[model samples]
Target: MNVRPAEPMFVSVPPRPQRLLHSEAYIKYIEGLQADSKYISNWDKQLRANTENTPVPDQSRLPTHWLGNGAGNHGSVVNALWMLRDFMMKDALGINKTI
Candidate 1:
């Protein structure tokens, strides 16, 4: 599913004005990551929208007792989301191969 970006996303890390690694491939990889990071904000928004609308069976809905316990807390969800998002962005940028 191709989702359009909702808003401009600034990369937390800026591009390296000068290549410190001195390898063409490495420099190219960094450039790709910079480009991917620019899309991160939109990507996250799409991911959130997708996840939010996911259908959960009423019978399987967690009770209040289980809401924030057993690895299902907000922190865990946020961490997992970030990890997945980072992985997807890196894959899109082809950093997976370089790594």
Candidate 2:
């Protein structure tokens, strides 16, 4: 038997339970738990930043502007996430690993 990493595999589809709240976000949260601390924090930061500010994609600012600051949970979520940096660095460097 051989397993080829690049070989295409087919999967059967299963319908999700109708009662689940946020199927995608829940999956993302779980996947983050499986990753290292660096990946979890940095990935969240990257995703939040990459989110589009305007409906017209790149037109909100320049096509290259960093839109992370105002992606909007009424402007609160982004602020709170960045605020974590005030107490400690995201890398958790020089601190206990269990932190």
Candidate 3:
């Protein structure tokens, strides 16, 4: 049985693009949220500046209640802060990789 060279088939497969979160509508929503008084903060301002001229999608900011509650609990906040600092140092600065 002879297979006639697969008939030189031309497959027109479209490329599957990655779905990035940074769309124009999403960017507009982020800008609007940044302008809102309830969510605006120094960090938010900085983030707005950084993201304004770029295409990076911003993560949700920590809520005000979280900050207030964390501040109200001294020991827990301290522990959590230290843990976060260490985590950032390790993951960002590549200090510790024992995970």
Top lDDT prediction, candidate number? 1
Clashes of each: 0, 0, 0
The worst-scoring run of ten residues by lDDT in candidate 3 lies at: 55-64
Lowest lDDT 10-residue stretch of candidate 2? 54-63
lDDT of 3 at 46: 38
Number of the top-ranking candidate, with TM-score as the measure: 1
TM-scores vs. true structure, each candidate = 0.23, 0.23, 0.22
CA shift of 93, model 3, Å: 2.3
Cα lDDT computed for each candidate against the true fold: 0.53, 0.50, 0.51
TM-score of 2: 0.23
Residue lDDT tens for model 2, 4-73: 6885587778988788567766787787675446554454455444235413334433322333554355
- Candidate 1 per-residue lDDT, tens place, 1-99, comes to 999878757657877688555666567655657553655244555456544565434533333343344335435544444445557766777965787
Residues 1-99, candidate 3, lDDT per residue (tens digit)?
Answer: 977666556877899998877877578767767544674334444334422353423324323344545735545544444445456555764645553
Local distance difference test, candidate 2: 0.50
User: Would you list the rank order by TM-score, best first?
Assistant: 1, 2, 3
Model 1 CA deviation exceeding 4 Å by range: 1-75, 95-99
